[model samples]
Target: MMYTVIDIETTGQGNKITEIAIFKFDGEKVIDEFTSLVNPETYIPEYITALTGIDNSMVAEAPTFREIASSILEITKDCVFVAHNVNFDYNIIRNEFKAIGLEFTRKKLCTIRLSRKLIPGHRSYSLGKLCAALNIPIEGRHRARGDAQATVTLFQRIIDTDNSEKVFAEFLRRTSKEATLPPHLPSDIFNGIPNAPGVYYFKNKKGKIIYIGKAKDLKKRVLGHFYDKTDKELNLCRETADIDYELSGSELIALLMEDAGIKQHYPEYNVASKRNPRAYGIFTYQDRMGINHLAYNILKNAPSPFITFFNITDCRTYLEKICVQFELCPKYCHLQEGVQQCSHYKIHTCRGVCINKESVKNYNLRVEQAISFTSEISSNKIIKKPGRHPDEEGFVLVKNGIYLGFGFVENTEQIINTEDLEHFLIRQKDNVDIQRILKRQLITS
Candidate 1:
């Protein structure tokens, strides 16, 4: 079988190809070679120039990708594309072809994966490092032709390794995911992911979680990331080297787990729920005249808040609703400030408490009633769901309107009350995002 060992230099941010090289090998011998510097038609970043030593001035007079496209297509036709990190080179070429309204498809192989299979026990599989350990000299480290040529030598060595024929066949099988997975990711790690509801963590080489996602089918969802050609997905896949997961037993629990993981890790790729939102609280205070007043403030200053809200609008809206419902004065609820007597345009059910038309004892009773009503609305509850496995049950615990967390209990365990669940409850912080997730589930259930 013919294989085209390839390498490319690209503008990092935009990923526009700046240079490419291809060496066609006929199993035992290098039969043909192609190399070119292409004008990327975009500004190359300083870091890329520093790495590859190929700058704007160097490529200014060179042919554009369109000019060399035909050469690339002709040289690589009917050959299995080979590269150190094959997906990076292959996808970039595919994307370039797509931009020009063409399709570039080929069965591909990653020398990095192959080396791990055939050579084994290497500290690293990067082209330069692998070559250094093998004593294979690379004339130019970052330049396309030099890297491609070195890759050709490495490919030839991989072909000659013992049991290479069987290894190659397995990797080349149509059912194999060897070519589709991220270069640094192990096939076994992906293969081990179960097709069940869970939260998955994508970690970089240093074992730091970079992204977290929840899915009803963990395997399918993680595979979808590899198929996505969007720039963000591509970048995310490129950096992922390991994966970790927690079975959630159900979608609701998966979502909760995902939120908690993202909040805890503050992963680089997780844009939402990474920062703590400002919290507003509804609280009550007793005045000198023996009247109880309802108010809202930032949580830090709100002593013993009756309820919490993430934004001023929601807090004020809830307060307004309770004010009108309980016939409490808007002035005391803090809906309108600097008013001697409550004269709220929307809330006219003040009962004259603001101007002492109503007795303090009567108004205080109404305020207490409103507080009790709020508590009743946010009562302690448990949402039961399917557990991670048979004979077990999953449940989300909410105590006094705050989400405690999710937990699993065996079939024989009897849960009679909120206190009964505390032993199995995995406590979690309540936040705006978590509230939003639970609200949707509560609404649906």
Candidate 2:
């Protein structure tokens, strides 16, 4: 089969191609070559220029990708595109073609994955390191022609390796994910991911967790990352080398597990939940007239809060519900500020506590009742869910309205109260995010 070993130098920020090189081989010998420095029409970052030695001035007089597009299409036609990290080159080219209103598609192979399969035990599979170890000299190093030429040599060596024909056939199969997976990730590892509810962790080369996600179908969700064409997903996949997962038996537990894992590892890619969310607290106090008043403030300012919420809107919403339920004045509850008496638009349940139509003694009694209701809603509870396997049961434990953790127990075990679950509990810290997760579960249950 004919193959075109290719490489491209890109402007790091926008990934615009600055240079490209292609070497066409007919399995036995090189028959054609194409190399060019293309004006990217964008700024090249200093770091990229320093690495590739391809600066703005060097490509000023060179042809743009648009000018050479047809040449590239002609030379690479009917050839299996091959590269050190094939997806990076292939996707960048495809995106460039897309920008110009053309579709670019080609069957591709990654030299890195092939090397791992045929020539195992290498410390690293990066083109530079692997080539150096094999004593294959790279004349231009970061330059497109040099890297592409080195990749060609590596590809030839991979072809000549024992059992290469069978390996190639397997990789070329329509159903094989070898070309779709991250260059650093092994197919076996990807295949091992079960189609079950779980929390998955994406780790870098050093095994450091970089992203965490919860999924009802772990395999499908993980595979979605590979198919996503967004810049963030591309960058994430490029850095990911390994994956680790913990089965949670159900989606609810998977969410809880995912939250705990992200908080613990503080993975770089998990941006939303990393920050400590500011909390708003609802509190109660008595005015000079001995009328009980409910108010909300930032958690730090509201000492001994009756109930807490992650945002001011939710805090206000909860207070409104309690105010209407107990017939308390909205003015006293801080829902309406700078008003002599409660005149809330949606809430007309006030018993004239603000207007003095109701006695302070009677109003205080209902305020106390509201406080009791709040405590009842936030009372300790347990949520039961399906287990990881048959004959097993899973449960989430909450005490005093705070999430303690989740765990599994055998169906044969006769468990009674929350105390019986402490033995199997996987303790986790309570946070606004976790609270939100559990609140949804409570609402749906």
Candidate 3:
């Protein structure tokens, strides 16, 4: 197998390559080599010169990257590029090619990753540190050729071990060409994406939303779609033509917007964001005995639910927890069935409402408390969260338990009254998902 071990020294801040080295090997030995100081055509920082000792005068008459670019490509062609921290070196080279209006891509292997997997017990993977530990002498530490030679030696040592073949195979698999933009989407779309929390809309050629999503970091999440191999992810990448976003200033607002946007647009590719199919709900009823009972009903014919749940298991789990907390009867809640007192009553966990040992008024009082606990969460109030800026605060407004939407308030005192908060809030439509998310948040908070 052929491998080209490579390394580069840059101008430090903007990362223009000032020097680069490549050693082409054919498994057993170095077959070819290239090393040069390149005229970055830009000023090299004083600190970079101190670290690399390659100053302005040294590279003044050296060939520019454009002059040597073709030679670098030709030597490394069809060779698996190997380096310590391959991503840093590879991206630097690829981007240099890109600036010259040429696209360059190559398979790469990182010795740092290989050493961790194969050697396993190294205290450090830094080139100088590792070479010192391995007793591999390296001269001219920061220069490109010296570092590239050290990496080549390290690669040889790793390839001689018993796990060499497996390790190399793993490297080959990981270093495959990275995921790229889909044919329908231009690369410039990513240039405009911000790293802030927001909701992103993926649209097709006709300007229709194909998917809607929210992320704590918008750029990272959208880029993740490009790299993901899942069928749904691939479909989103393939169908997307343009990307749009709204900064929510906070994750809660982003989530709220995501929920409403999905429902509003009903995007074709967003299956997970579509309305829930489960009709499971938690409800209340009064039996003939004038005892109130909480029950799990599947689309149960009640006028309204105490609160909707996604499934019977969730509904039952919630009811059980509420009953346990309030010391209500398992039988009264329909969690247990029997002619005599329920099991919870025997254990003293139940307040004997099932057997009428506890007065109807007292037991029903706790039931009312549990019902009110959930019902009141839907009540009007300002839900505060961290804002985009340190001096600002974000809030979600829920009036009488119906979500009014969200907004940012700069003056925290403005949130003390609903009338003032209304001036800030941007209204959002009410959807079951939004309601459910808010319900969960209120319960947890």
Candidate 4:
């Protein structure tokens, strides 16, 4: 492969390249070189000068990136552009070209990643650090031309040290060209993706979305579908045509995006919760004598709102357990046959309420307590919980220290309005899953 071993001296964190250089190579040997100093529109930070010795005066007479970009691209046209941190240099070049209305796409390679692979043991791998450790001389250290030349030599040494077969094997796997993607993807799509925490989308060449997924480790999870570890993942990966993603501030946002994304994209791999299925929520209502009872009821059709549910068995199971725990009559709760004194009454477990052996007032109190367990009788305030990042924010809603549900908000202003508090609350089917998770979290927190 034609290799353009390149380097750039940039403007600090802004990363705008002030100087660029490329040592063109045929196979493993350097054949030619190109280097230039660009007149950046911004002031060169002092630290950058101390590091690279390229002061403003030195670059005053040099041709700018716009002046040399065409020639630079011409020289490196057929080459695999190689650098220490390929992304930094490549993105800078691409951005510069893009600013001039040119689209620059190239095959890229990172010496840092390559060294980490080829040279298994190294305390540090910074260009300067590695040069010192490996005995490569640095003429200009941080200057683009000097750094590019040094990197070329370093690449040569790396090639000689590692067997060509071994290097090629891993190289082949690493490059977008050589590796097989998930069966559903277009070639090399995973190339454009970043290894950040985010939600991802899969699309075909036609740009039709096929799937959506989220990951704490985006690259690995997207790559995992192709793994041989589990047949399931392999099969799932096979059907994935293209992958796309959004970087979330944290895993929480990734999950939120994932939840909304799957619904939007409607990926076939997704199995659970298809666009909010109407859960047959279990509900409770006060009858003639004011006894609380459990029954299958339309969650949205209730006279008053009731707890939502997903687990059909647990819907009934949960309410029955609550009734039993609170000594509510199964008959009054509509869980037993006929109102002629429940089985609980015969077994002395009903407190004689069903048979009127117990006062209506006493039974009514217990009934109220049990119904209150599942009903949303009040809506005074909603509190959202914060995320786990540094700039990350969470909230707790308390009216007279009465804890409402913990919710999440983006910023301070969002938390000011009660709408933010209520809106951010994740609307889960008031199923046993939600009750269980929330109960445990709220109690523990």
Candidate that scores best on TM-score? 2
Task: Kindly list the per-residue Cα lDDT of model 4 for residues 1-445, writing each as its tens digit.
Answer: 7888999988775666789988998767778888888988778899998888878898888887788889888988977788875656776788788888887877776676567556757766678888888899989877888888888888887767747557555555654432334423434577777776778886654567766778877888777655432434444543455576776645544655676666556766666643644555556566776665566665666455355454455455665666676877778766777658787533336778777788878887886776665444222334333454445554434342233433455555435676656666544222333333333332223
Q: Write the per-residue lDDT of candidate 3 for residues 153-230, one digit (tens) a residue.
A: 999998888878976775477433222444345446766889999999999868899899999999888888876745
Off by over 4 Å in 1: 273-377
- The positional error of residue 394 in candidate 3, measured at the CA in angstroms, is 2.0
Residue-wise C-alpha lDDT for candidate 1, range 151-213, written one tens digit per residue = 989998999999999999999999999888988899999999999999999999899999999
| Candidate 1 residue 317 C-alpha distance from true site, Å | 18
How would you order the candidates by lDDT, starting with the best?
1, 2, 3, 4
Candidate 1 weakest ten by summed lDDT: 436-445
| Per-model TM values vs. the true structure | 0.78, 0.81, 0.53, 0.46
Which pairs clash inside model 1?
none
The model with the greater lDDT, 2 or 4, is 2
lDDT of 2 at 71: 91
**Ten contiguous residues with the weakest lDDT in model 2:** 436-445
RMSD of each: 6.8, 4.5, 19.0, 18.5
**Per-residue lDDT of 437 in model 4:** 36
What residue pairs are clashing in model 3? 378-401, 379-401, 380-400
Q: Which is superior by lDDT, 2 or 3?
A: 2
Error (Å) of candidate 4 at residue 289 is 34
